[model samples]
Target: MLALRDSTQYAHMTPAHPCDSDDPERRFRPLSPVETCVDTCGLARDSAPYFSQHNKRYGVLTMANGKQATARRLKMADRAQQLQDLHFPGMPEILLWHRNRHDGFITIPRTLPIVMQAVDAQSKGQPAGHTLFCLWARSPDHPVLSIENPSTFAAEAGFIGERAVDTWRRRMKKLRELHCIETKPGASGEFHYVLLHNPNAVMEWMHSVGLVRAELYSRFIERLADVGAFGEIEAVRQLWAQQQAAEAASAAAQTAATVPAAEADATAQANAAPEASAKVQIALPELGANL
Candidate 1:
């Protein structure tokens, strides 16, 4: 029954674009759901990707099984192996540094132990569940679910010119295609949804499951539960639910312009997926203190 310092206020404290929490030039994309997509926007992954030996950009290691892969790709894989192995490092500094700055929650990335405990005590067989709404969906494991506005969701987490509604349903559609963080229903449809699958469903059919970060996220939450932090997790959930209820119409569109982090504070409240399948998983690390 450990309490989480009444973290209900954490939501209101974050800046509009937490991505800008650190580097102004580089907007840290909300955590990758499972693994970083090899091909997409941002730093275009060449069709013939060049694995760097000392890729200082992300500090990616280039040697795995004598082959080369991006550090971004390996981070996800490392997380998966760490979970099954149960080595509690006690803070996600790597994640925060990669994203650019302090998360406002902790000076250091909290080791997955406490987080894992909190998640388990709450979710009832549902993946991530209410707790999902509590933690930052922009973490390394969860990543940004969808920045796209409602219009994007309707188009199957895509753009019409771009949009969606029936938010949860759209989320499900997005989930089935890629492996990413569990997203909320509020995306206004004009933003970029950090999804694992191609935002374009038809494209997903031709492509492959995007990011499976959700699966890992679910597992991670459960781990957090094992260590007795459920109460804190619940407090976060209650606060978030209240915020969502108050802004039902506009909640999905909490983008930079619409929800400016400053005014957003006055209004209060806020906000992955990773990379691959077999080899690695991405986004925020999953919870499972007792696994």
Candidate 2:
């Protein structure tokens, strides 16, 4: 019963449910009852009287035909629900839960539409799941309707639904923690746009989290040099060098401080040996005089 109800929540009914249906006139109508019965009954002399039975149940039927109809409706609803959950779960409620007046069907939520050209440029052998999330995170303005060829992406980075969701969640969390990205509430007050307009913001955040490798950093500097951002790159490089030199100098000073005081101990031993030698000579003279 719960399954049926859940399935019907998103299902498209000819006469939609009271909650979803917009027509105030039909909203008060009572739900129609469903019935079931056996068709054939046979009687023989050996067998007692055969009787046909009718199921007088009032709610929706649960027989084969009814189940099929329910299943079909549920499948469509489930797909729509999945897409909704991925793109626009609860935000910008105005656009997400809108009903089409023409066909009385609910349309899919409008995500930050990614264009095909951008997808073609970025979609290179990455998993569909990763590609989708990456597009959402990196290129929200350019939404990819469909992949031209999904095979390479599926083969290389086959991130499925759960893994993809987790990965994107972690990325967003990191971005927020570093203050590289900010979420602005949509007009509807339910949806948000993840903004990444500042390139340096992300790079700095990545550096803080140790996400940028040395080689990659060097490459980034080179690219900056190609343009006119060399001054900024050089400043960063100088800071790194200063830090490294300071650490090295501190380590050298610590090493010198740890050396043992061997020279002072050796000098003390030499002075004590001379005094002992004199004492031995004096004792020898005293013994000769007594004899």
Pick by TM-score: which candidate is best?
Answer: 2
TM-scores of the models, in the order given: 0.17, 0.24
Which residue runs does candidate 1 get wrong by more than 4 Å? 1-212, 248-291
Local accuracy of candidate 1 as per-residue lDDT tens digits, 101-169: 544342222224333333333333433322223223333443344454344334542324422345444
lDDT of 2 at 115: 19
Please state the error at residue 240 of candidate 2 in Å.
16
Poorest 10 consecutive residues by lDDT, candidate 1: 44-53
Candidate 2 deviant stretches above 4 angstroms: 1-159, 162-167, 185-191, 208-211, 231-291
Error of 1 at 140 (Å): 22
Candidate 1 RMSD to the correct structure: 31.2
For all candidates in order, the CA lDDT equals 0.34, 0.39
Question: What lDDT does model 2 reach?
Answer: 0.39
Q: Write the per-residue lDDT of candidate 2 for residues 1-291, one digit (tens) a residue.
A: 111222353222222132323453332232211111122332211111110111111122122233454576578688987998898777665555444323334221121121112222232343122333443433434322222233333333344463654444443344444444455555422114555423433343354466555444434433332333334433554676799999999999887766545666778899999999999999999999999
Clashes of each: 79, 11
